[model samples]
Target: MRLHILGICGTFMGGVAALARELGDVVEGSDANVYPPMSTQLEALGISLKQDYRAEHLQPAPDLVVVGNAMVRGNPAVEYMLDRQLRYISGPQWLGEKLLADREVLAVAGTHGKTTTTSLLAHLLESAGLAPGFLVGGVPGNFGVSARLGQGRHFVIEADEYDTAFFDKRSKFVHYRPRIAILNNLEYDHADIFPDVAAIQRQFHHLVRTVPGNGRLIVNAHDAYLAEVLAMGCWTPVETFGIGQGDWRATLVEADGSVFTVHRGDELIGEVSWPLLGNHSVMNALAALAAAVAAGADPRVLLPAFATFESVKRRMEVVGEIGGVRVYDDFAHHPTAIAATLAGLRAKVGKARILVALEPRSNSMRLGAHAQALAPSLADADAVIFLHRPELPWDARHVTDALNGRGTTAASVDALIASLRDQAQAGDHVVFMSNGGFEGAPRRFVDALRP
Candidate 1:
């Protein structure tokens, strides 16, 4: 089959492209801005990529067009496809119809931690000799590639709650009817698409409705929102995990927050001492462990995999260090995510100054929907620098004003870099938070910090 994908540069769409290529389909794609590492990954697969969306790019008229959520009604390529009456489908639908139909799908879904949790579960299944196929948003350090077609019957996927496509307003996860579903946590996000927390909860309920009666729903025991989501309706067998509650739980072991003990209903399972930092990560591990168990793997036997598990790239990924100052990159744009990331870093570097370089890049953040909550979220950080781009809808001054005295807004990437270079001390951990590249500011900071 010859397939053409729109918005192939996106993580999910790129993964679809790669998976299709691996399945022996001729794949080609186009996007507005194509850069590493998805671009490089696609190139390595010998898939041709076009720069921008144009009708001419569809000259060959492949057998099918996989539309990404990024495409809108007026996109040139989309309009062309519609005008020509060519067959098309959303990425999730195509994936469901193609890859997940026969496999036992283990899906990880939440407002945050989906990528990491999915990657961890896939790694656990791999270690257990399941060799599960997976399609994660971020590249797991354990596996060099983000998407793979494994030889096993299990398929682990990072199920996002975002809309499927322009034509389809429903959440993407509804298309993936997984046998095992992990609800990490729920919070209000994607302000552009969702009106409020309840709206997102409704979508989550829709996801729950898709699970078969014999399947399992592994959820965070302490999350009030997730509880509410489950209260709506759930048919699948459910298991919960948290710090101190649920059928499964984890107890912090060491002061540095790198070690912890796992428990299942008061029975000590095992101790896990990993390099992953923060309580959120521990919760992610618990969710992954529970999901793996639901998939027929033993937590006691797979405990060693948790200890050696390498985290997903860009999730507190340390880029470099200069004069003892460490620079980290994270894909945290939402207020809840920012808080979790900062808290995790604080747990690891107690008493050490933690500086944050933040970009309000996501559509929700750009709309200022999360502006009021932003300052309180960064309260754990010693200091913060905000990257203010003019294109964003909200005013950066409003965010700075909310911070009282702990925050300063930089109008440009260069200004943000200079501010970091001057304020960051030897013991400071400079963390850059954004879903996008932040104009390559993370690397620029590391480069400037280099001697």
Candidate 2:
């Protein structure tokens, strides 16, 4: 089938384009502001990408049009589809019809670890000779492509609870039809739609309802919310995993640098070490392991693959270092994610001056709903530099002070970069952590340090 997608530059939309191409679909797409990496990925798949959305860009009647959740009714292609009475669906819904329905789908869902967990599941299955098809939001360094269509029976995907699209208000994962659902963790997010934690929980419940009776549910036993959900009991077979004892649990053996191991666990049917850091990553690994096992991947076959796994891009990704003060970037905007990332960095490097550069850029974060969570998340940093100059939904200064007055400074990006350059010395870790690009602050910061 031929397909045209709107807003295909997003990581997930680009992934859909790749998946569509691999599945023998003639795929094309348009985005308002197309940029690197994803644009390159789409082009490599031979998927046509138009820079700006135009109604005319819709070519001779395609079988379907996949609309990204970010694309609204105002988009030209979207409007054209409606006016022409052409068939159109959300990206996830298209994927559900073409790839997920009836097939064994190992879905990783959470506020933070979904990408890593999904990527880990893909890696484990591929190594086990499953050649598993996958669609992950972020590019896993292990697989050059974010989405791949293979002959294997398994389909692994990142199951986000975010809204599907303007037309479909349901969670995107609701369309995935997961057979083995990994509920990594849940928290209040996507403030645009959700009023609080309970609202997000309902979205997750909707996803759980999609799983078949034969399917299995593996949840973070440690997450109080997921724990509560499990107590209520859904129809599918359920298992638990986390720091606490459960069906699949991870006890950290050692974390020397960004390397750690599950000291013990029966879910893998064997004890094995992983090459990623943080308690969060360990939990993600366990979630992936459970999903892989549920999909019939041999515990032994995938165990060895974990040792050679490389970290994904922008999750503690060090882009450059000058005179020992490293400039790194991460896509952690949620308070939980930000805190976990900082903790991981702290464990990897010792006693170094860890400067936490922050931006409240995510839909929920930008609105400052989680203002209370901001301070404690940055406690790991030696200093906190927050960008809240243009305007803040609330007083960011007061929030920083609430955490601690010392070493907290709120400045514009330019001023923050200047301050970092002036104070940067050997052994300092300059972390630019935000979901968005933070206005290219990472590149600008590195350029400032270059002699």
Candidate 3:
């Protein structure tokens, strides 16, 4: 089969392209903003890339055109596919039909924690020598590739709730047909599409509807939202996990550096001392263990892998650190994600002055919801700096006063950079948190702080 993928430079699309090649399908793709990582990866895989979308690029009609969600309607390639009546499938749809079919899939689904949980599960399986093939939204340091084709039948996937492509408005996870699905905490997100939390819940309900009767649904017992979903009746059996006692429980056993431990339902189900720390991370590990168990891997097999598993590329990725000031970048744009990220850094860095550089970039955050929680989330930090661009409607003055009232110094990043340029203090952690790349804030932070 020949596959022409649109917007193939994204992490998800890159994985799809790789899967196509591994399955012996001739692959070609195009993206407008092609850059490192994906570009280098695609070339290494020997897949051809078209810089721009053109009707001619679809020459001779590939067997299927996998369209990325980022490629919206009216795109030349998309329109051409439709006008010519050429069959097209979304990236997720293609993956489900071509790769995941007949495989035991362990899917991690939630408004948050999908990437972390998927990486943890993949690494956990690897620790047990399961060597499961996996696909994650972000690049897991443990595995060089976002998606890999391997010998194992157990496939771990980061199942997201975001709607699929422009044509298919259903959530992407609906197609994965998870044999073991982890329902991590659900919340109101993607405000641009989902009007409220209930709407998101409905999409999750759809995913639950598809799980096979013998499949397992691992849910956060503490999430009242998920509780409502389960109360509605499920076709598959459900297992619950949380900080408190349940079928599977999350207990923080220990922490040193990035590694941490979890005690499942009173028994120590091995340690997860990852390069991550937080209640949310604890939840992520719990979900991974549950899914691993469902996939026939021992829950205890993940401990060693957890220690060596570096987090995903942008989720708390430390670009560089100079002197005592450390700069971090993370793809945390939602309110819950931002709060969790700040909390994790606070736990790791101790009492160092934490300066938060944030961009309100996601569909939900770009508008506003955590207006109140924003200051408190950063309250652990000594100072907070917001880098609002010209178009975003965020009012820095309100955020400034809120943090100031909470006894934290607040300023704009541009201003903070100018003020801190002379010298970086001995104990300071500059944590830059955002879903979108903050236009080199990590680099700029180093340049401004280096003495």
What are the lDDT scores of the predictions, listed in order?
A: 0.92, 0.81, 0.79
- Model 2: residues with Cα > 4 Å off, grouped in runs: 59-63, 255-271, 389-391, 406-412
Kindly give the number of clashing pairs for every candidate: 0, 0, 4
Give the TM-score of each candidate.
0.98, 0.93, 0.92
* TM-score computed on alpha carbons, candidate 3: 0.92
Q: List the residue pairs that clash in candidate 2.
A: none
Residue-wise lDDT of candidate 3 within 18-65, one digit each (tens)? 988988999999998677668888889999998988889998899889
Model 3 ranges with Cα > 4 A deviation:
59-61, 253-261, 270-272, 405-424, 447-451
Candidate 2, residues 30-65, lDDT tens digits: the string is 898687678887887788888888888886767888
Deviation in Å, model 2, residue 117 alpha carbon: 0.4
Q: TM-score winner among the candidates? A: 1
**Candidate 1, superposed: residue stretches over 4 Å from native:** none
